[model samples]
Target chain A: DAGITQSPRHKVTETGTPVTLRCHQTENHRYMYWYRQDPGHGLRLIHYSYGVKDTDKGEVSDGYSVSRSKTEDFLLTLESATSSQTSVYFCAISDPGLAGGETQYFGPGTRLLVL
Target chain B: EDQVTQSPEALRLQEGESSSLNCSYTVSGLRGLFWYRQDPGKGPEFLFTLYSAGEEKEKERLKATLTKKESFLHITAPKPEDSATYLCAVGEGGGGNKLTFGTGTQLKVEL
Candidate 1:
């Protein structure tokens, strides 16, 4: 569906360790986003990139960082993983220039666990 | 602050049962309202987008309607395959493609 795929569908890491999740898209959309889903807290935006080398913080950007060096790849990194950071992370892409383009399609998602 | 609240955190219905899920929101300037269906272990899939009040969109057994303060997702004769979590989100003016989401309503269709 949107040619979006997230690597490391499931992962387990200990606290204070470094972890990075990857999102790859084939549609070459102008925008890509990262979100985390938790029990009782729905999905919250983590970060997003509009284009190569352009990125912005989201509602829950603390403890996380992202980089976009190419149109097809977006990466999210946790500086030091924490138990509280364990959750399902999702990648979404959208193209505002197309018809009904505001709609964001999502990737399969990555489940991360911090021990 | 833009906020969205979905009612009845969870619902269970027998096959062919009709029901409706509610989504209420408050935003400074409403740009768009979106509905998505998320299956277990998967990401959300776009369902509908309502730009203004008094608008309605439908696909198969699902119909989405929007008003000034709320939106409703109505299901007609749902099948077991219809079981999934429904999410509602709102895009506010000047938000720059960002959306505020509700917790979502989980629906389970039984035989």
Candidate 2:
């Protein structure tokens, strides 16, 4: 366990309902990311935070929002869950380094089903 | 646009068999290439990071090598426990912590 954890290992929600997933890291990494894994698509980034209150959109950020209020916690919120949003979500954290590419440690992942 | 592509999509190997998975990438400036192993229903586990061409890294029965345009994850005498989806990601300079990932190659090992 390299200090990354995601809440609600599994979830089922109705379409149009608001839902939020939480990612917590004990490592205090500078970068945190949220990604969704679908059938044919690889893990596509949804949102990421470089620091507290500093976030940016990823390739697939529509309908999703992320907030990082503290160093260890990053929250991803779906304003209105859709059936197309049913997928496994993953959280990852990476340390800052000169390598320009620090290795990311991932959480167990959350399986979400929109019915 | 930065992109990564993994080959075969899926591979089946008997226990103790050796094989390699390929990852081809196109980026503006390559900063690093990473390899990860993911079990079903779990997040990806970091395996290795290759920062430059001609770089190679190894751990246990897995060896990762990188070149200017692609990378490879080579498994030597793989075991049943080595069965998992092997993912490859590329990080580009100036991308600001963004990583582009490939679809991944799912490896199955049977005893």
True contacts kept of 1: 0.68
Ten residues in a row with the worst lDDT in model 1 chain B? B91-100
Given candidate 2, what's the lDDT at residue A66?
91
Give model 1's DockQ, 2 decimals.
Answer: 0.80
Q: Model 1: how far is A99 from its true place, Å?
A: 2.1
lDDT (Cα, 0-100) at A84 in candidate 2 = 92
Which portions of model 2 show Cα errors greater than 4 Å? A98-101
TM-score of 2: 0.97
Model 2: colliding residue pairs: none
Each candidate structure's count of clashing pairs: 0, 0
Off by over 4 Å in 1: none
User: What does the i-RMS of model 2 come to?
Assistant: 1.5
lDDT of 2 by residue, B1-111 (tens): 999999989999999989999999999988679899999978899989898899999999999999899899999999999999999999877845788999999999999
CAPRI classification of candidate 1: high
